[model samples]
Target chain A: MTEQLVIMVLLSFLVVIAFGIILLKDLLVAVILSGIYSLTAAAIFVVMDAVDVAFTEAAVGAGVSTIFLLGALTLTRRQQKQQKHNNYFALLVVTLTGALLIYGTLDLPGYGDGQSIANQHPQLAQHFLQKSEDEIGIPNVVTSVLASYRGYDTLGETVVVFTAAIGVLSLLGLRRRKREEDPELDAKRQCRQQNEEV
Target chain B: MKYLALYNYWIVVIIMMAGFYIMIARHNLVKKIIGLGLFQTGIFYFYVSLGKVDGGTAPIFVESLEAQATVYSNPLPHVLILTAIVVGVATMAMGLALIVRIYEKYDSIEEDEIKAIERQHWQENNGEFGISLTAPPTASS
Candidate 1:
């Protein structure tokens, strides 16, 4: 469809823009590009018929992550220096792995034939697509699968989120020390806050 | 052709994984974050693709139950992906906040420099003067 073509082109553009962000010298623009990247992904999700995902992408990608990256930038050097030299050995290893992965994909099922064995096995999630209404009280089959028969998996996923949150807290949420005596840092903090408010 | 859709998705994945590899291997903090975002985009693509049934209509409902019986692409993936997008933003925000702190403490986000400083601290804490008594032959020797 024409729409899918547009989505593909847009995805390519977004990837290029993301690369530009990384390749740029300034850290600030890199952080901003990260937000743009997230927004683009959100838009792509929209074309894919994934409204829920798109919403989350926009909120987290554009809203919160950029703020965090900028803060991280403040803690880092303003500009990254060019690498000392390219390591051919590392590049070789990466290329070899990539080649293998591409080769491996030849075995994968083609786009939704529905007759693919992966689609038919009883163990497959097709039950939800077929006989869920009489069993699970929910209309959304994915939700039913996520919350009911796979409750344990759902619980594991929750734990994963909890662990991720803990990691973020430990990694990022350090409490401020008493800045009363450190006039230099205190002044810097005040200036930063002022810029933020404005 | 029908196969074109599959190829399109694979291309998306390849680009995504490339970004992920950069994140994992690159020392530059900003570059790493860029990689992370690209990797996430790939995942978004995977979820969105899952909902694609050929000739499928949007998940929107019509008043006529009979008309609604026609095939429509699944909407559930879209909903799920939306939630993930929100979470991604939160994670990115938190990550950036950490990067700020890292910059403040180390004054450089380059992994090598941070590691060097950390090693120096570790050495001081452990009081290692040079090589350990039972260490293997040194390259210098």
Candidate 2:
């Protein structure tokens, strides 16, 4: 019972954080608020007995990503250049989607309800609980899923990474090796030159 | 309280959508990356949330330490997401690396500024040089 009360409070706090992210005008503050939202979600995961997820949320969502964003932002400017205009048609589409989502949720099972499709599936989930050791030889079901069942897919993903690296290498040769042959560089030089003239 | 768990999925969905919206709608490149980060985290949370078992405890299992083996939650999600977090970190690192290159190319990191600069660059070079000159220098090799 106490858990329920505590969770409700935290959830409200999360909603507030989300709204804060949305409402903030400053881009830096918005990013920071987004971190708060991730932390709040982590806490909520802990409340729901998802400590692993909470750890990931705290580490990746809050820690590493924050640093990455800050680094990226250093190379960029903050202030939004063009103001976004409100269009009623876009609003209606968003609203209708939200309404439909709410309506769909009406049929969902109650929170943490034991009889959820997640829990009910014996062959899928219960098997993990029962025979995870003998069959897959791994205690962690997620590992079994990611490493074995979908291992090939992850390998393919790594290949995609390699492909991207090659693409970048071929497109942007090293500075000393091959000077930027791009006429765009010339144009930027021209722009800089023009700016200097002004 | 059970109802809240059911609704938690909605929170994940909302976070994901908000992140997606920010990534797409916002003109700022850094904000777009942040949006991408948010959106990725939302999916991570969703996957992690799916493994929660009611009345469960943490999964600190040791071969020598099964004495406290209560109804512990699944360890798989934690382990899986651990890898995911590492991958995400690596990906974000690579993204920032790309942003560094973007900064070098465009001079101005602001998306709108970069766009303007690129457009202006295209017009200036295209009118003056055309294909008579070599391809413009992209980040590629």
Best by TM-score: 1
Model 2 lDDT tens row, B1-141: 545655656765666666666655556666666667666766665555566666665544346545655565555555556566666666666666666666556554456555556566457555442222233455321
Q: What is the TM-score of candidate 2? A: 0.70
| Displacement of the residue A148 alpha carbon in candidate 2, Å | 6.1
Interface RMSD of each: 7.4, 4.8
Structural similarity to truth (TM-score) of each candidate: 0.72, 0.70
User: Fraction of native Cα contacts kept in each candidate?
Assistant: 0.31, 0.28
Model 2 Cα displacement at B133 (Å)?
14
Report, for all candidates in order, the number of backbone clashes. 23, 14
Model 2 chain B scores worst on lDDT over the 10 consecutive residues at: B127-136
Q: How far is candidate 1 from the true structure (C-alpha RMSD, Å)?
A: 8.6
What lDDT is reached at residue A170 by model 2? 48
Model 1: docking quality category: acceptable
Q: TM-score of chain B only, all predictions?
A: 0.76, 0.78
Q: Residue A159: error of model 1 in Å?
A: 3.8
